[model samples]
Target: MFDKLTRTFSDVLRQVSGKSSISEKNIQDAVEEIKIALLEADVNLRVVRRFVNHTIEEARGEKVLRSVNPGQQFIKIVHDRMVNLLGSETEGLQLKGPDTLSPILFMGLQGSGKTTTCAKLALRLKKEGRKPLLVAADLVRPAAVKQLQLLGEQTGVPVFAVEGEKKPVKVVKQALSFAKKNSFNTMIVDTSGRMHLDDDLMKEIQEINSVLKPVEGLLVADAMTGQQAVEIAKEFNERVGITGVILSKFDSDTRGGAALSLKSVTKKPIKYVGVGEKIDELEQFHPDRMASRILGMGDVVSLVEKAQETIQEEEAEELQKKLQSSTFTLQDYLEQFTRIKKMGSLQSLVEMIPGMKGNIDEDALNSKEMKKEEAIILSMTLQERHNHRIIGPSRRKRIASGSGTSVFDVNRLLKKFDKMRLMMKKMTKNKKLQAQMLSQFNGNI
Candidate 1:
């Protein structure tokens, strides 16, 4: 998401990494480039200054200056300092035991995606084996309660809301009793928000907070708002006392100003980030991995985690068996496409691979090309999928017509599939190549 920052850091690294040794002047030059990049990205001026100063102080130390690889040493210093600026480690929600009613109060300005985040968090907690109830306590906005209700339906989490309750505190109080009676371990209350922070808004939130005695008063801020998100978090932390922050629309936050500045300004950890509009697109924030991604070093840990979450172990083992036996078919190939799509956008996944950042065509990876491939594969008959070689010219034209593509497109896909199959067959027979591939895969994990 930090595309600009990543490109700048990559450029700076390229200038320094190839050197046999680096001088203080070289470090200052690279740091200055970074400072400008951060500023352009809308990062806080104070944060940029502090980050720049700390990086220079560390880079000028004898340890980096006299190191065998000064360039690499300097890069490590930057990565470490960036991680600290982003919060040194991941911080999770502090919850009581499942037997207790752990209320999580959500607060934010209108249009910050606070209601949707409540559902997302509830779904996540449900997946983690907690009985979560989504409380639609956002009474100020006309459709907020309905929105939360619809979201709860989509997520399969129950929503607790009085039919006509106007006071958020009363709604939350009733929700607590309902949750405890129903054995719900976690209650996520979507409190009211406003266009701007007003005393009435703060008072309503504070009253609800006092009633719920929430374990986590999370402020959901729009990452696209840049520095304004940090200011909003500070205000909420001061008035309503937020325990953590959740940055919504983070996937679209290409500049990454809010995420880079939030922790430094508010001292509140970003517990979760809404990566996409889908209910399942929320991700836990990892500072070290984010730092790596920002430096164009990739985030293999997050990539592997996405794989583990979306791909079933049995399915992976079955695919391995098919590959070893040279029995992989177009059906298996299509299934693999579906699995990868579930993991995330191809561009995002590619960014997680080391050295692959900014090296992909966004249109090609995310647009009609992939959809066309899937359509062509789906147009194939079961027998054609199992035995692609059996498709003659007539069948090719028929499949292309069914898929709304030209015969040339179908042929291209078949050729690509054939090449892939041949490679897999070769790898199956080559024990040494297979071992090397397995070793690399395991090492990434």
Candidate 2:
């Protein structure tokens, strides 16, 4: 996500890092580079101009040019402006919480993933111990109701849809009554949309809004749509009054113009972003964290939060023990891969590591190489997994045949495992290096 923009910023900052002192020409050159990067990312032209002007004015200030570390100071100025451009701070759903109606109305153009985003929001609320009801108010689109209901069942969230009621307002009324009777604290209404903005679609959404009186009117915009998304958001806010935005299909948006342009254009914060197709892949948008990620600083906080969700305490302790004892094996390696897969794509994880963004090819991570590695381990015997040393040439050939791979593949796996073991042993035995690593891990660096 935002890989191209991140790389551009990285290149400009890398140049600044080599500067002996900040000069007028230095700031001018850097700002020019930034302008080109933003324009290439498809950011709103007005927003990019304002950004360049603001950055240039600040970078030229005495406080920045005379700073002990001028490069770091200039970076801070740009980060602050980007944060402001992205929304000065994180904003959440304006729900009262408890026995209230708590209607969260979702609206967007057709094919914006609004239905799935509605289900994702319901799942999130359900996980937070709130009883959420999914209201399928998208009566215009054929099978939209059925789609929402299927997603609701899959996510273990209840759905309310009145059969044969073509009127979305009527369906929502029934859903509200259902929620009230069932004591549901949250209600998410999936509204109808058209291929493009139209009077009929806007009127239907406005009527739905009037009936639901939602606590949050969220527009589900596709980040891939670029500036058109910003325009959609503005029109929605003007016509139906959206409270926030949910950037759907954001994980696939490499340029990231919509995410950076939406807030500035609509004056609405992006409350959530759809990171993947899964129901659990929705993430709350954080301005500071996104700013850090955009600047190649990585989002360690989000990485740790993701790990907390996927890794258990005892499992981590057991992995630590294995590392310390130098007892890691093929089984452990396979298990590690499975865990990382659960968290997200390997490329996304790599992007979250500081200085490694845009350096990994996502296709490479998803290629036959990963599958072959897993297959080779699965073909190995239990004893072979515990002690790979017993696997000779004949055993390697058998394992390769069993795994539908070549003998060379087996050899490659063994060599990689040997390198990993050596690295673990080297790190565990070096006390000073271990201390330095601990300090860095603890953010002392």
Measured by lDDT, the strongest candidate is 1
| lDDT tens per residue, model 2, 339-428 | 887888777777777666766666767747888999999999999999999999999999999999999999999999999888887887
Best by TM-score: 1
TM-score of each: 0.96, 0.95
Clashes by residue pair, model 2: none
RMSD of each: 2.0, 2.0
Worst lDDT 10-window in candidate 1? 436-445
Determine the backbone clash count of candidate 2.
0
* Model 1: per-residue Cα lDDT over 1-445, one tens digit each: 7998898998898788768888899998999999999999899999999999999999999988899989888888988999999999899999999899899999999999999999999999999999999998888899898999899899999999899777888888888889999999999999888999899999888888888889999999999999999999999999989999999999994689999999999999999999999999999999998998888888888998999987889988888788878689999999988888899888788888877787666676764788898999899999999989899999999999999999999999989988888788788779999798667644332
Which ten residues in a row are the worst by lDDT in model 2?
A: 436-445
Q: Candidate 1 local accuracy as lDDT?
A: 0.89
